[model samples]
Target chain A: MIRRRFALSPALLMSLALAGLLIVVVLDLPPQPGLAGPVAQAMDQAGVGHPVTAVLLNFRGYDTFLELAVLMLAVLSIWSLGRRDPIPARPVQGPVMHGTLRHLIPVAVVTGGYLVWVGSSDSGGAFQGGAVLGAAGVMLMLSLPREMPMPPALLQRLGLSLGVFAFLAVGTAGLLAGHGFMGYPPAWAYHLILGIELAAAVSIALTLVLLFLGGRSRKVRHDR
Target chain B: MTVDVISPQIYLLCGVLLFVLGLHALVVRRHLLLKILAVNIMGSGVFMLLLGVAARGEGGIDPVPHALVITGIVVAVSATAVALVLMLKVKAATGLARLPLSGPED
Candidate 1:
């Protein structure tokens, strides 16, 4: 019988050793003191009790706006590639999947709404809410038959662009009021942030689902 | 040496480990899908590092990094989607999942 080498490969061992060293260096670094910066001052003016949301939507609203634009750009790039052949639909989902979706989708919608609402004062926010909605959309896509037509293109496009459009409108209004771009008046900040979050949640959900679907809208198969 | 592995340092170490693992996978893997997954893993590692640092900050976790990480997550997802679409386009055009390696003659 031929004897085989059992030791780890040199390259793999080297990589692991390097990683271990890097980890040690990182672990040895001294912890830096927290710099809340202007967060405390902005928090009261932000109109949201959750510090993270306040930071994301108010103090750093410009970042969020740009992030939405980035998402839109990604969708546009995917669309420009034209459509690919759709993955063949599963022959049929089991009764368990169909039943679970029937119950789960409604719960997801309610939970998503609650997440957005509670974001003002707690841990949840637009992204979390949007993800929940997106997950529901994915479930629907997987469970529903391929013959079921997708929503109209126009409606889908509207949903995709809604978040960035709302953000731009708000920002432009702020500029007109001499508050500078993305700066809402302190008194109106709460309502404005809420409006933006709602629109963003919708846009995010639609965009995420589209990303998962890939390329263009799927064509409904005539063979049932 | 006494090591408090349960502390934030451990999380930071984990992030570093993940980053290295992803980097290694990207270097070693020939399949486009694996590369994409490796890139995502790298992105997650960066996010983990950011959160770990945020957790270590005095007076509750810093909201600034948390907000930044949220933005990062969204950006990473968008980037990944674009990458996957590009990969699909490449595969469609060339009928090959992996790109051809550069030759010495070239």
Candidate 2:
């Protein structure tokens, strides 16, 4: 088979031109303060010490809520495709993988918990922490034998919906209290934010694990 | 002038290059896995651009963009998962992991 010599295809040329234009444009962005000033001004009222967390969980809670919903929707779509294929069993050369998983899982749990907690005052949050936990779950799933049973369907469903449910509950409460949707009473802001983060973290982790699993498990009976 | 100084402009340029490279790959690559990876690279470029912009604030790095980027990352992950599952279904149904070429010359 004759391999075609490399040439500047139309696609390559177009992308190259586009890159040039974008590079020139991005080099001189307008000098502006951005939202940092506004975010700082409202930090006292936003409840969280960390600006990013305050923005995500308080000022822009609706976005986070919708993000969780999107994640759930992805899992739903995957389930609609078909039941999950069991993870293939690959023989380990030694107990290294299993031993590593046993040691790492505990550490991951602790780190994930710490990340969620520190998110209120630092550069960590539900997504970061949940990713760690999800990785741990994936490891667990990969190491398990083919006959190993997954968690109960009901329990899985609960975990998947926990984030969205918690966010909605908080938002509705705010609406009822006339603080507007997703608004926490200033006094309860910290607690509400923390509660939502914890729930979101759990949901995110479970959702990621499920996504990795690729579809619903057939072994677990689904009640109509 | 010594070229040792780093700035957000460097990040912006790199991001643009990455996005363009991904777009080029997406157009040329026939493999489903390459397409997915190209899309991810495109997303990373966008994320990088957002971060560069966030760093442009006078007082400090902007929080709103940071929040938006976080949201975007989650959305990207969700999209990639859906795409992967869809790819598998396509593979199972068609017995090919690559897209059919539209052009006859190849």
Candidate 3:
């Protein structure tokens, strides 16, 4: 299989040109206040701590939780697809591509880990990193030509559950932290965030890995 | 001198391009998976434009859009899953991947 990067020659030109024009428009236009200024301001007024993180977890957490469930449903849907069909023929050639994927898979896993580690401070996050890692797994699967690439159903389940389980389990840790229902007490805030991020990373990777598996039908054996 | 500036219309165009690309993919692609990918590519493009507009905020990135994108991402995947499952069932019944024929093979 070809390396997965999209060669956005025209897309690059278009995006840049559009971005440039927007620069001019934003300059001509008026400015507006931040959307969450009121809520954040109230937090400051009331002496609530770490309002940014608080807003992310408690105030707007229902959306986040639902997002996690959506990922779960994606996995389940893919899993069900596999059950209905026997398996897809691994028509993809493996021996030729094996060398390249073996080298790349570890690199992807590492990159994914780093993304999760620094997501809070940087652009990388569990979703991005996990997707990257999942790409590596897909690469590996593509390279292996279907003799026996997939791990057992149990492992698949673990991969699917890793993120939601991690996020919710830690969110529940709030009870122990004395912060009640999705609240992270001040003292363990860092640890809790870190844990949630790590778990999310695993979850996202698993989700991406499984996304490709979604509409695949059963493998048909053909005599050459 | 002052810093350089970007126009909001660029943001609008970005959203337009993304939506158009998605539309094109929906029309042109034969593969079930490729169409889904196109849909996501379109989503990312529109989302990028939205984020660009959000950049107009004073503090930094607008959390509201960020949150929305986060929400969108989840919803997108959920829809994707349902679509894929439907596709698979179609494939199982028909033995052919090309749609408009998700029916069973005789």
Off by over 4 Å in 1: A1-14, A17-21, A91-94, A218-224, B1-6, B101-106
Q: Write the per-residue lDDT of candidate 2 for residues B47-95, one digit (tens) a residue.
A: 9999988887798899999999999999999999999999998999999
lDDT of each residue in B1-106, candidate 1, tens digit only: 3453357777788889898888888876678988999989988888898888888876668889899999999999999988998898889888987856864678
For all the candidates, what are their Cα RMSDs to the real structure? Answer: 3.2, 3.2, 8.2
* Candidate 2 vs 3: which has more DockQ: 2
Question: How high is the lDDT of residue A48 in model 2?
Answer: 86
lDDT, candidate 3, at A83: 46
Candidate 1 CAPRI assessment class: medium
Q: What is the DockQ ranking, best to worst?
A: 2, 1, 3
Which of candidates 1 and 2 reaches a greater TM-score? 2
lDDT per residue for candidate 3 within A65-99, as digits (tens), equals: 66777888776766665643323555555565667
lDDT by residue for model 2 over A1-224, one digit each (tens)? 35567777788789989998998888867878899999999999888899999999999999999999999999999999999876666455358877887799999999999999999999899999999999998888777544446678899999999999999999999999999999999999999999999999999999999999898787664332
Error of 2 at B50 (Å): 0.5
Which candidate, 2 or 3, has the higher lDDT? Answer: 2
TM-score of chain A of each: 0.88, 0.93, 0.66
